[model samples]
Target: MANASARANSVTVENQDVALLKSTTVGRGPISDIAVDGDTVVTTNFGDDSIAVLDSDTLAVHGGVFAGQPTTVAVVGDRAFAAVSSASYDAIAVIDTVSGEVVKEYPLSFNVTAVVTSADGKRVYAGRSGEEGVDVAVLDVTAERVGTIYVAKAADATIDAMCLDTTGRRLYVGVTDSRSSRLITVDVETSRVRRTLEVGAPIRGLALGMEGVAYVLTSDIADGGVLYVVDLVNNKITADVAVAAAPTQLVLSADGTRAYVVDYDHVAVVDTEKRAIVAEVSVGARPSAIALGSDRLYVADYDGGVTVYTVAASTPMLYSQFASALAVPAPRELQPAV
Candidate 1:
């Protein structure tokens, strides 16, 4: 059953090459992000301050939990950490999937723009974008904000997007100030800036793929948008691939060969090696986030709904493999002298 205030609908488009399997309504609010853990697909509802858990196969609602105006969610084992961005009350609601309840609320000093767990489940990295500066708060498993890594020192700067490479040693952060925008890499253990590559525009999205490579999406309404390939080892931008007008989010394929970019009107598949758009599909209305599973691509459309598109099978993604590849030895909390 759909939420009382929400409407539900579904559509399937068939074709010889690719197909749209099922397009269905998800929640009553705008979908902020989509994440898959096991067989369950979870979405954060920015409008209603709630989270929805859906069956990945049927798109059926399993349950919903109140998260206090959440923006992004990260799943670690049995708990989903949702960033609650309300001014009156800012925290991370740790919800247990089995019970569909918020078990914990970790308070934050600033507004959390994004939340992503460490490759290992031992730490949680939350991006706090404030008028003073942008910071990455490192939270322990107990949901306590123990340490903070400053990304930008300027009062007007903001952290736009962030992603971790296969190895947690590198945390790629996108920072934009009045002067310029750049991609900054920070060392996880030392919490020190390693490199900075000026991109000149707000980085809307970032995706880390195989071999220490990153795909950065930058957009300007007047200048259009571009996808930049950054070689982490070299600490430089290697290629710039043109994309749709207003690319919002990006998802890299399991094998890291393809990148799926969602814009206001279409989703473009770009071959990573070739750095070019290989295929284009028109998805009416503005599409937001995307997740791949079950030989299908699931897109969250703010106006349309949760649309499922059938795609040719590729190498299946293993959650454990990602965790292993990006996992780092747990860093201990700094202790004051006794």
Candidate 2:
């Protein structure tokens, strides 16, 4: 078993080659979502139900806190909110970054699959997976209270992925199933569904861009996957770009010109404006999630570990800018509330 402070094994690939800078081992369990603040990297270890805080530059374990089956996490200022699930119950554990201790735990009825905080860190939105389709759980960080919001009403479909708009006033949710998928938009203040667009394919991940544009990723077991660009203003799908098989997640570049996609065994760099695949980088067996820093891309692998990739300076963009404008962390499960 791996401990919280265990040393990480580092590996380096060429700078322009695949964007890989180093790979770090966070003990021996499955890793989920990751969040980055100035010099700290926070990760959730699902297998151990613990949170590991690492030195961003050295990738060394700095501190950790044990939460029960933590599946996702979001950071705001000096705090981190982690969604944890146990056999009998589910909760969100609040951790104080300065002390590395769990300060509070907000109980929930369903398992949380996705979590994101407002830019000011005043509010948090958690997505839950269940048959009832009660997708979103709104949390007031200052008040320590929570409320529920339903993105999808059907009993069969669940929330697959989530991201907040640039203003943080609107939230985009992907509701998907084997047979169909839909994009649901919600007004943050009222916790009400604003618009529901029927996106035909099965959604795997989601990302947003300029002028109310949303990039939706859908996978077909027999035919690989596709990236769809939807114009929210017009409420229609405008473009479709083909990608590799099993595209798990999407992260837009700071300028909104490129999108980095992580699939089963590789990461595909897509030129958003061109609607084409520009680069493909090989990775571990099961790359579950990804997080973008100022100049790096952090990939969480279930079997291999966490790999840090350098974002070429020539790209002329930062992940944090892109993350701040759209989304940062990836989805945790197939039917995600986030």
Candidate 3:
């Protein structure tokens, strides 16, 4: 238990999820996807046939470029990659966050459901799904398809979600066929399957954590949803945390302590250490996507509305505590004056 002095200084953290909420609308049509980096937030507006970039703090529209039915988006540094997968268009539209212009396009032979990038924005990995099979396309920042990794061969198998580990050496693909669902981990260097685990339900989202842990969200009609904690190093599941019945996306914090899950009408906050839900935030309507920037949480509804909140993260909280503790005047509380 903390002392009374510590209690007096108990930082009033506004979730920083699980509290402190602000709602903002970006009217561009129903949002298909959302991604945030620094002070920028990008959303793919499928119905509007464009993407919208906004200031993360003010909810002000920065600028956006038009694309042909942008489905999903990812951001690395100042660049944003949107997967445009309409009937006539199948390409990766690259945009500059500051100018909000589609500077380049990488024509793709297939449609992608998930898009992720390397830490340095040098490479983009796209999850391609079709009737034939599913594979991951390795794309360089120069708007070129470098290579492809075969993820699944089952006829009509589709990749539901794709996540790259912190080290960027491992990629996890959640694929579901007509009969079963699976989580496949692949080595980036070798471009080979490292391990495959049966999930048995539709995978909604995936996020990697510290110490080789993978958090996967699976949705079931009858069973609702379950957040499975898997040990990547041991190749086993460590815990199963329940969540919403129908979920769309999952975004984990950089510290890997909390996971924000976008369910039907709310965001479920789960504590990784406790292996339980710490809070549920009401987002209203259908939440299509979610992203995290620093301690800020961005939840985008299918209707194109986004809500922002400041969630508690390990690094920021530690710094906040230390800074506060050090600001004590004259060391009155100092023990032994040592």
Every model's TM-score: 0.87, 0.85, 0.86
Candidate 3: tens digits of C-alpha lDDT, residues 164-188: 6555667799998878789999887
* Model 3 root-mean-square deviation: 13.2
Shift in Å, residue 51, candidate 1: 0.7
**For every candidate structure, what is the RMSD over all alpha carbons to the true structure, in angstroms?**
4.1, 6.0, 13.2
By TM-score, the best candidate is: 1
Worst 10 residues of 3 by lDDT: 329-338
Q: In candidate 1, what are the lDDT values of residues 8-48, reduced to their tens digit?
A: 32232232335665666766757888877666777887867
Q: Which of the two, 1 or 2, has more lDDT?
A: 2
What overall lDDT goes with each candidate model?
Answer: 0.73, 0.74, 0.76
Off-target runs (Cα >4 Å) in candidate 3 are 1-18, 316-338
Better of 1 and 3 by TM-score: 1
Candidates 2 and 3, the one with greater lDDT: 3
lDDT by residue for model 2 (50-139), tens:
898877777877788877888788887788889898888898888887778888788887767778887767668888877666578877
